[model samples]
Every structure is written in C-alpha cells, then in structure tokens.
Target: MLRLSQFIFKETRERLGTLSFLINSIKFVTLAVFRILKGLFMNGTKVFNKEKIMQQNNTYVLIMAGGVGSRFWPKSRNHFPKQFIDILGTGQSLLQMTYARFLQICPKENIYILSNQDYKGLVMAQLDGIAASNILLEPSRNNTAPCIAYATYKILQQNPEANIVVAPSDHLILKETAFLDKITQALEYTSKNEALLTLGISPTRPDTGYGYIHFEQEAVAGVHEVNRFMEKPVLKKAKEYLASGDYLWNAGIFIWSAKSIQKAFQTHAPEIAKLFEQGNSVYNTSEELGFIQENYPNSPNISIDYAILEKATNVFTIPADIGWSDLGTWASLHEVLPKDASNNSKSTDHLHLEATSNCIIHLPSGKAAVIKGLDDFIIVDDEKVLLIYPKSSEQEIKSVAGAMVATYGKEYL
Candidate 1:
C-alpha cells in the first residue's frame, strides 16, 4: 500500500512540470510577435510623416516669356523672340537659362512656362527636358495681367497650397546665387505673411528707362514697405529719388502664393478674374486653345503693377543687390556686356577702328562687321536688315520698329 501511494505522487509531480514548461514557451512566442509588430508600425509611421513634410515644401515657378521683344528688333523677330536667342553667348537660350536657374529650387514638374501659343514649339524645343504638360500657352496677346491670372488659376487648380514666383524670361541676372537666395527668402515671407512681394533691385544709376518703387520705411532685413510706384520719371525726379535714397529700381520679379494673387485679381480686376474662372475648366486639356481664343481677348490689357500692386495696401519690397538688368534696350545690353579696352562693346564678329568711347556693335551671326570713326552707336545685323542708331536714342528703338512694321511688311520686322 505505501509503494503504490508513492508512485501516484511521483506521476502527479511529472504532469505538473510538463504543464509549466508548455505555458512558459507559449508566453515567450506571444511576447516576441508583439514586439516585432510594434517595431514595424513605428517605422512605417516615421516614413509616412517624413514624406508628408517633404510634400508641403513643394513650390511652383511661372516664367512669363510671351512678348515679341519688339525693342530688340532686327535680331529679335516675331517667330524667334529675344528669350530664345543666345544673347549672352552662354550656349543656352534665355528661356533655357531661366528654367535651369529655377530647377535648383523647385522640381522640374513644378516649373511652368506662360508663353504665346505661336512660340509653343520654340518653348518645347528649348526646354524639352521639362514635362510637356507643364507649359501654358496663351492663344492671344492680352498683356501681363491676363497671362498672370490664367497661370494663377491653373496653378491653384493643381495645388491650392502652392507658392509661386513669377519672373520674366528675358532679364539678365549675373549673381545667380544671390538672386536665388533672395527669391527663397521672399517665398518664405510670402507664405507666412499675407502680403504682395516684389523684389526691387538696388539702384546703381539715375536712369529713366525703368520704373521705381518708393518705400516709406524698411520693413524687414533688406526689405522695405512700398509707399508708391513711380513709372519712368523725368531726369530731375530720378536724380532726386536717387539722392533721397528711398527708392529702388522695380525688377518686375514677384513672389506670392496662388491664393494671394487670385484674391488680388478678384479685388482689383474682377472682370479679368471672372474670365479666368470661367476658363479654368479647360486648362490642361485640348480645349484650352479654343477657350483662350474665345475668352482671352475680352480681358483687360492692364499690368499686374497697374491693376493690383499700385493700389494694394499690403505691398512690400525686398531691396536686393542681386546684379539685375532688364536688357530693355541696346544701351542696357551694353551696360551688362563686357567691354574691350577702348570702352566699346562688340559682338562675336566685329572690327573697330578709332572707336574710343561708349559704343555697342552686335552682329547676331558671326558675319564680319566693320566700323570706322564712330562713337556711341548701336549696329545690329539681322541677316535681312541692319539697324544703325545712336545709343542715346535707345528708348526710341521700339517705336522705330513699330513704324517700320507699319510702313513696310512684316518681312522687315
């Protein structure tokens, strides 16, 4: 009886030990699975948060290159505008260079070209690497205001939170790094503040060719609150502006969010804004051409400066010393181009004799050009015709081209 009782006790002890071992193994596997799942979930959350942050920083740049550049005539014709020419001998067209500069700040898909419908092929050929859908073509030449409004509406449709930098395609910027830095700063400010921002170039001369921005006080670091906009004042007024040190050359570069610009249009130019709103449905579609052709001509021919900036209360200016030139006329081109020892600016192929002071000779092609006993003159050869005018009369070149187009056929233009 004693032996049988001992055997039963030993068997019960063995069964209990086996049960304890099975419970321990199950607990270990459950804990391991929970830890692995937690780790995977945390990593996925981190990656998703990073991607969202990157997307919020995205920006768009709209380049206005639609004008015919009638001022740079003889060389700059209707079919081939100044923006498509290699005026700086940099082996890249103006549009190409402008697009490349913005690529450093924004993605290629975010860059847009608002140009004439006629120059669509030229723009595409020059900027072939950019996506074809990004280019916005105008069916007619209404002016800057309509062009900007259309672009703003289209951009807002794509990205409601988009910030845009609108720039001209033909201007020459020497200090690219400084220019880009200034643009980035302006974008940051505009995104945060509800203001219309324009980059004003530091005035180096009392020239009457460009517009001026009058500031009452410095708003921020290197930025000023614009008091008023003065357009091409007289020589006396220009000197006074220079002496007062409260003015800057309007560089015509603007940075603002899509919402801000759209609001400005709605407030200042309601008719044009309505046109754009009605035409927005056709954007990025084959019907864009037909819609613009039908609706664009009825819009106003006002500039953004005249339509909104001049009247806006929240206008601000960033006075940038970013080495800028509009290249508006022959004299301005001479100012930016390198001069020889005799203080004369000559193109790739030119011969000068006894030309000691202040002259600009530009032959578009590398054809031999010869000049003698001339000073302060602009000589431009466009293969079909040549222009010889005084550098002092540079502002009259556009009027001269218009008169020629009227008198002769478009062949001479």
Candidate 2:
C-alpha cells in the first residue's frame, strides 16, 4: 500500500512540471511577437512624424509674371514677355531660370506662378511637367496689391503656416548663390519672426530707376530695420542716398509669412483683402472663372509697396550684395550683357561698321542692321517693326510701342 502511494505522488509531480514548462514556452513566444510589433509601430511613427515636420516647414514661392514687358519691345512682344525669351542665350527662359533658382529652396509643388489668364498656355508650355492646378491666373490687370493678396489667400488656404516669397519674373541676378542664400535667410527669418522682409540690394551706384529703403539703425547680420521707403529719387538725391551708406535699392523681392502679409493687407489694404477673401470661396470650384471675371477688375489698383510697405511700421530690409538688376530698360540690359571691343552689344546677325562706342544693336536673322559712329544708341529689329533710338530715351520706348499700336492697329506694336 505505501509503495503504490509513493508512485502516484511522483507521477503527479512530473505532470505538474510538464505543465509549468509548457506555460513558460507559450509566454516566451507571446512576448517575442509583442516586442516585434511594438518595434515596427514605433519606427513607423518616427518616419511619419519626420515627414510631417518637413511638410510643415516647407515654403511656397510665388513668381509674379503678369507684367506686360513693353520696355523690352521688338524682342519682347505682347504675345511673349521678356520672361519667356532666351535673352541670355542660356537655352533657358528667364522664367525658367527664376524657377530653377527657387527650386533649390522649395519643391516644384510648392512653387506657383501668378500670371495673366492669357499666359496660362505659355506658362504650361514652358513648364511641361509642373501641375497646372498650381498656376494661379488673374482675370484682369489689377496691379501688384490684388495679385499678391490673391496669391496669399490661395496659399494660406493650402497651408496656413506657409512662408511665401514674392519675386518678380524678369529681374536679372549675376550672383545666384548669394541671391539664393539671402532668400533662404530671409524666409527663415520671416517665418520665425513676424517681420515683413524685403531684400534690398546694396546700392553700388546711384541708380535713379529703383526705389530706396533707408536703414534706420545699425544693421543686424547684414539686415536692417527699415526707417522709411523712398520712391524713385532724382539724380542728385540718388547720389546723396548712395553716399549716405544707410540706403539700399529696393529689389522687389519680399518674404513674409502668409499670416503676416494677410494682416498687412487687412490693416493697410482692406479692399484688396476682401476681394481675395470673396474670390477664395470660388477657387477650384466650378464657379471660379465667373467669380474672378466679375470681381477682379473692380478691385483697387495699387502697388503693394505703396499700399503696405510704405505705410507699415514693422518693415525690415535685408541688405544683399547680390548682383541685381530690374532689367527695366534696354540700357539696363546693355549694362548687364557682355560688350564687344567697341563697347557695343549686337546680336549674331547684326552688322556694325564704323560704330565707335556705346551702341546696342539687336537684329533678327535675315535682317540688315547698320550703325555708323553713333554713341549710346539702341537699334532693334523684329518681324513687324524696327526701332532705332538713343539709349537715353529708354523710358520713352513704352510710349512708342503704344503709339505704334494706335497707328498701325496692333500690327507694329
């Protein structure tokens, strides 16, 4: 009887030991699976979080290309502005070059072109791969204030935290690296601070064509708090400004957060702000075309500089030594272009004989051009018209084109 009882006790102990081992193995497998899943989930969350951060800090560049570049006429016409011309012989248009420059800082998706509705096809043809939806078209010419406000409203709708850089389409920059660096710094500064930043080129000469920004106090890292804004000054005043060393030429490159600019428009140009606000409700909707056609032309026509920058107290200027030119006139173009031995700029087919110095000749192929002993003259030939004038008369070219259009019914314009 005692031996049978001992055998039963041993068997029961062995069964309990087996059950303990099985339970330990099951717990080990379950813990291993849980750990693998947890690691995967954490890694996924990290990747998603990083992507979110990048998207949040991303910038949007708005290129204002709607100007009728009547100054560069004969070569630049109403059908195609200077921005679409390969004036530099670089195989890329000015607009393309500008887009490429900004691509270093912003993605293509974030870059936008605010242009005339008529130029939509031109823009699409030039920028083939870019999405068409990104291009914002203006119904009519309402000047810079409305254009900027509309672009700001649209961008803010997409990304409320968007840092926007508004740039002209036809400015010439010789120092691209320095220009891009200044732009990046401005964007970073404006995003972090609630300041309205405008890149002002360090005035190398007394250029009366550009507006000036007077620096109030000592500069902060090559940037200055703007004391006041000056429109195009007279020659003597411009010389004085250059000598003062506290002035910078307004380059028309502005950087500000969407919120900051919106507030500026609200405070200074409330009419433009309301127009855009109304237009935004119809953007991307079926009624977009009708909405703009009805409302855009009625908006007040004013420059952002006059409407906001000239009046705003929170304006700042970044002094950039970047080689800058507005390229507003033929004389300015000659200043930037390479000159020949006789100090003359001529296209490939232009023939210059006895042309001593200070002349620009631009003639198309199959056209004959001759300049004899002329100083500071501009000679341009297009398919429809030919222009020969002194370089000092650069400002009158626009009027000439307008007169030609009036007389010839738009054929010679």
Candidate 3:
C-alpha cells in the first residue's frame, strides 16, 4: 500500500509541475472541507425550526396554460397550442420546460397544471409522471381570476398550508439558477407574511405589451409594497413609466400562501370567492368536475389583477433581473432566439443569399426554403399553411387566423 501510494504520488507529480501539483492538492482539500461544512449546515437546518421547514416542504406550483396562442397562427393551432410545441427548438415543449424548472425547488407530485379541459390529453402527453388528478381542467374560459381561485381551492383541499407559485406555462426563462433562487426567496418570505407576492421582471425597455406594477419607495424583507397596477399603456405612457424608474413589467407570476390568497379573494372578490368556497366539501373528490362545470362559467370573467391584486392592500412585488419573456408574439420570439448576420431568425435549414433582414421559420416535416431577395419579413411554412408577411404586420396574424377559420373550416385553425 505504501509503494502504491508513492507510485501514485510520483505519477501525479510527473503529470503536473511541482507548484501546479501543490495548488491542485490545496484545491482538493478546500473542496473536501466545503462538502463537510455544507453537510453540517444542512443537518443544522432541521434543528432550527422543524415546523417552518415542514411548512416549506409543502410548496406547490401551478402552471396556467389555457391560451390558444393565436398570435403564432400557422405554427400554433387550437388543438396543438404553443405550450405543447417546441417553439424554441429545444427538445422539451414549453409546458415541459416550465414543469422541469419548478422541479428544482418543488417535488414532482406537488406541481399542478390548470388548463382547458379540451387539451387534457395534450398536457398528459407532454409532461411525464403527472397524475391526471393534478390537472385542473377548466370547463370554460373565464380568464385568470377564476382559474387561480379554482387552483387555490383545489390545493387547499390537499394541503391547506400550501405555499403556491402560479406561473404561465408558455413563458421563457433564460437563467434557471437565478430564477429558482428568486422563487425560493419569495416562497420563504410569503410563507410567514400575509402577503400576495408577484415576481416582477425589471423592465429593460418601454414595452407596451405587458402591464406595469408601480412599486412603492419603502421595502420590507427585500420586497416592495405595490403602489398600483397599471394596465397596458400606450408607447408614450410606457416610456414615461420607464423613465420614472419606479415600474416593473408584470410577469404574471405570483407567490402566496393558500391562506393569504384565499383571504384576498374573500375580501376583494367576494362573489368569485364564494363560488369556489361553496365547493369546499366537493374539492379533491369525484364530484369536483361536476361542481366546477356548473358554477365556473357563471363567475365573472376577470383577471387576478382586476379581481384581487389591484384591490388588495397587502400585495408585494419582488424585483428580479432574471432573464424572462412572455413569448406572446412572433416578434418577441425573434428577440429571444439567435439571429443571422442580417438579423434573421430561422427554424429550418435555409439558404439566404440576398435575404437581408427577414425571419424564415418552418415547422418540421414541411419543406426546405430558398430565398433570394427579401428584407424585414416573416416567412413561415407549416404543413398545411405558409405565411409570408411583413414583420410590421405581425400584429394582424391573429385576425388572419380567425378569418381563415371563418372562411375555410375549423381544420385549418
């Protein structure tokens, strides 16, 4: 054993110079010491506050993915929405990516999906290991307020003390580590405080697409009190808010305890809250779907912003620099994807000779395209339909899709 150790040491010395070997040895020792300290620290966490840790362990995540993604037109259809397709060229779909992102902080069984009942099979096909019971299938489209209330009541049935994060399944997050860290901090803060916390993305530009959150000057526990919630403003107002340096782009991501949000609804949105509250005995049971189908559509169609956040006094905001995008439009997708020399983003293999500034996108199993002269246009080819329009006219695509469905049939939609 002594001879073997000597041989090994001699080989290591030969592979590395004298000083290099010593530095490597020091690094190894330092890493070992860090591991030991980390183990001790983690063990000590269990002793500090057992109940707090247990409550945190009950963290739940709900992903809302009911939109049809009409803006993406030919690529995103009613049956197969953007969330189920890999719009970013990644192997996983957007819903799958959202589920995977939360898996870093929450257990698999704790993550739930709130989507349209028509797309229930698609949700199951995209996400693995998700129980059918965890999918909250909305009987009709009632917007975000009713969607969130139903999910809250459902989770409350399983775990009343559940701390939940409600996020859109179609959004893109570039920095997973930083996003998870921010979520962890928000969860820890909301677990103790009776606060409705929403993750606010620091605005890089005066984007008119998203709503803005007005943050107050005072802060508590690294969270800012919400002064007001602004609707999507014109470019002029957006620039004013941006220059004022007091607004954050509302990312539609929220975190709060089941109790806190329930109370908020009870106080501000009593009518909608009462609808779900009446189902307390039926929730988590077989009669849940029937109860939802009967009462969900009757509830007022409103957003969580309108029904609660705008009216609730205990709302808070967490300013985060995590790279985020709602991915709401083709133009937005072009911003997050890689571009060519002439500022073109393509999905399929293409040969662009004089096509200077254009986005040439194609779904799989269609056709390879060759372009010669085009500038600042969108060239997308789905299997059944191909769209060629100016980038400036991207906003009209949704209307075009509706027109197609009206003129032709629902098959193309």
TM-score between candidate 2 and the true structure: 0.83
Give lDDT tens digits, candidate 2, residues 67-178. 8789998788878888887665455678987888777778789889989988999899888698887788888887898888877887887788999999998887766656
Whole-model lDDT values for every prediction: 0.78, 0.77, 0.81
lDDT (Cα, tens digit) per residue for candidate 1, span 1-413: 12332343344447657666344332233233333333433442212122332356658898999988888887789989899987765567888978987877787888889998898889888997867778877777777889889888878878888888999999877666667777877877788877899999889889888899998764675567889999999999999999999999998899988999899889988998899999677777888778877888888888888999998888898888766788888778777554555567666534645744678777754477667777888888888878999888877888898889889888777
Worst 10 residues of 3 by lDDT: 44-53
Model 1 / residue 209 / CA error / Å: 0.6
Per-residue accuracy of model 3 over 65-101 as CA lDDT, tens digit each: 8989999888999889999988776566889989987
Prediction 2 global C-alpha lDDT = 0.77
Off by over 4 Å in 1: 1-57, 285-287, 349-352
Q: Global lDDT for candidate 3?
A: 0.81
TM-score of each model, paired residue for residue: 0.84, 0.83, 0.85
Candidate topping lDDT: 3
